[model samples]
Target: MGLLKFIAVGAAIGYGINYITKKGPNGRSILDDITEDAPEWFNKAKTYATEKVEEVVQQARPNSGY
Candidate 1:
C-alpha cells in the first residue's frame, strides 16, 4: 500500500514540525496562536506574575519599601 505509506510519512513529518515549533522560541505556536487570542486565564496569570516581579524589585532596591 503505497497510499498507506504516504499517509504515515506525511503524518510523521507534520508531527515533527509541530513539536519543533512548540519547543523552539519562535514566538507563537502555529495552530493556537493563529486560531485564538491569548486566553483570559493567560492574561490573569500574566498579571499575577507581573505583580510578583514588581514586589521582588521593590524588595531588592534600597529603601523602596513597597
Candidate 2:
C-alpha cells in the first residue's frame, strides 16, 4: 500500500511537471530556461554550502581567529 501510494504520487508529480513545462509564453519549453540556469543555481548553492561548512569549521577551531 505504501509503495502504491508512492508510485501514484510520483506519477502525479511527473504529469504535472510535464503539463506545466510543455511551453511558455515565449514558445520555448520551461525546461529550456531551467536547463540554462541550472548550472548557475547549482553553483550558487554549492558556494553557500561551502561557506557554511567553512564557518562551522572555523567555529570548531579554538583560537583560530579571535
Candidate 3:
C-alpha cells in the first residue's frame, strides 16, 4: 500500500510538471521563464545565504577587548 501511494504521488508530480512546462499557443512555457531567470534568482539566494552565515559566525565568535 505504501509503495502504491509513493508511485501515485510520483505520477501526480510528473503530470503537474508536464502541465506547467507545456507551452501554450504563444509557444512559451513556465519552464522557459524560470530557466531564463534562474541564474539571477540563484545569485540572490547565494548572497542572502552568505550574509546570514556571516552574521551567525560573527555572533558566535567571542569578542576581544578592542
Candidate 4:
C-alpha cells in the first residue's frame, strides 16, 4: 500500500512538471528556436556562452586532466 501511494505521488509530480513546461503562444523548445532559422548572432552568442560555461567547469576541476 505504501509503495503504491509513493508511486502514485511520483507519477503525479512527473505529469505535473511535464504539463507545466509545455510551451504556449510564441513558445518553442530551445532546439526548435535555435536551430536552422535562428540568426547567426544568436548562434554565436550561444557558442560563446557554452564556451564560457566549459571554461568555468575546467577551472573548477582538479587539474581537469584526462
Best by lDDT: 3
- TM-score (all chains, Cα) for each model: 0.38, 0.66, 0.70, 0.38
Models ranked on TM-score: 3, 2, 4, 1
- What's the TM for model 2? 0.66
lDDT string, candidate 3, 1-65, tens digits: 99999999999999999988999888999889889999999999999999999888878885952
Tens-digit per-residue lDDT, 1-66, candidate 2: 999999999999999899768987789887788899999999999999999998888889969574
Error of 2 at 66 (Å): 11
Cα-based lDDT for every prediction: 0.78, 0.90, 0.91, 0.78
Predicted structure 1: lDDT: 0.78
Cα RMSD to the true fold for all candidates: 11.3, 3.3, 2.7, 8.3
User: Which ranges of candidate 1 are over 4 A from the true structure?
Assistant: 1-38, 64-66
Q: How many clashes (backbone N, Cα, C below 3 Å) per candidate? A: 0, 0, 0, 0
Off by over 4 Å in 4: 28-66
Runs in model 2 with CA error above 4 Å? 1-11, 64-66
**Sliding window of 10 residues with minimal summed lDDT for model 3:** 57-66
lDDT of 1 by residue, 1-66 (tens): 999999999999999777756834767666566456558768889999999998889879969555
Residue 62's lDDT in candidate 2: 67
